[model samples]
Target: MSGESAPRATVGSESLERAFGGTAACNACGARVAEYRVVALFLHETAAIRAYCARCYPAAADGDYHAGGDGLRLDYAAFAARFGAPGPPPPPTTPVDRMLAALVADPALRLLAPGSEAVARRRRRVPYPVRVGFALDGATSEARMSVAPDGRMTDLAGDPAACDRVRALLAGI
Candidate 1:
């Protein structure tokens, strides 16, 4: 690991559990993690932070150093503006947040807001599908995708091309 130390206001295990319950998902691999390290990334005129499980931290750090993992490349200023200094770095958003943000940004996809019956129904399925809300000209009016436990988009109810696009977006995250 690099010589860098943890950021200020870094929360301990008790705070983490209070903020995110017993399990928090790894920001990179989407695995449910009970233990993790939080790092604030400063790069290319941007700053943002994330919590990474042991397995994915190395790769995420490597990617940050190498300027890989493009898309909404977390400008530090923007992050600071959105989440001002104070308490623990805003807990990394859940995998669902990442997924919804990606889907909403794509013009070809019309993201569904949570709490709808459609979204709730899909969430009930075995293995659970990430209810995408909707996609324009998609295979189904109600868009939902099944994601592997690892966070990969395994299948989607939409045009193959749109699905591919969504998958690519998710992969970048």
Candidate 2:
């Protein structure tokens, strides 16, 4: 197995059909495939996620599986450049982000919050609003964190304890 490679399924083959579909394409080569592992450099609201094929992906790279997108081929080197050694992950969510996700999903939360604009602002203020929403239900809220375009937590509600806790959590990161 050291020198051998995993068999490549044809684009329309059944094996490929079963495994692939939503996988992201390689950032550099644009190979839409499911064979590569995903290498994500955790970013704030989003992840600099990339996929690498067994051949194109780094054999020694570590991270999650690569799901393809568009028609991009996996590019292991480029992915490594971005993710490298990701800084500490985001903090756990406040009670607010969690509630909003559930509400967004059920449509009831959006209806009940003060107003659409207010709710939106709260979402922006919350940690990892896009990913860790309802998933981190009771995750210490104190550790909940988010990343903004400027690469820092833009807002944390500033309720003393919450602000201090997150500030400490994101200190050098």
Q: Pick by TM-score: which candidate is best?
A: 1
- Of candidate 2, the 10-residue stretch with the lowest lDDT total is 107-116
lDDT against true structure, model 1: 0.43
TM-score of 2: 0.24
TM-scores for every candidate against the unseen true structure: 0.35, 0.24
Tens digits of lDDT, candidate 2, 1-173 = 01111223322222322333556465335576665554332222222334455565553132222222322222233323432323333444344333322233321110112111123344455333322111123332222334442334444452354445444433523
Query: Per-candidate RMSD vs. true structure?
Result: 14.9, 16.3
Per-residue lDDT of 13-132 in model 1, one digit per residue for the tens? 223112344555665455767776444443223333455677866644443211111213344335445445333344444454455445544544433323122232344653445544
lDDT of 2 at 46: 27
Alpha-carbon lDDT of model 2? 0.33
Q: What is the C-alpha lDDT of each candidate?
A: 0.43, 0.33
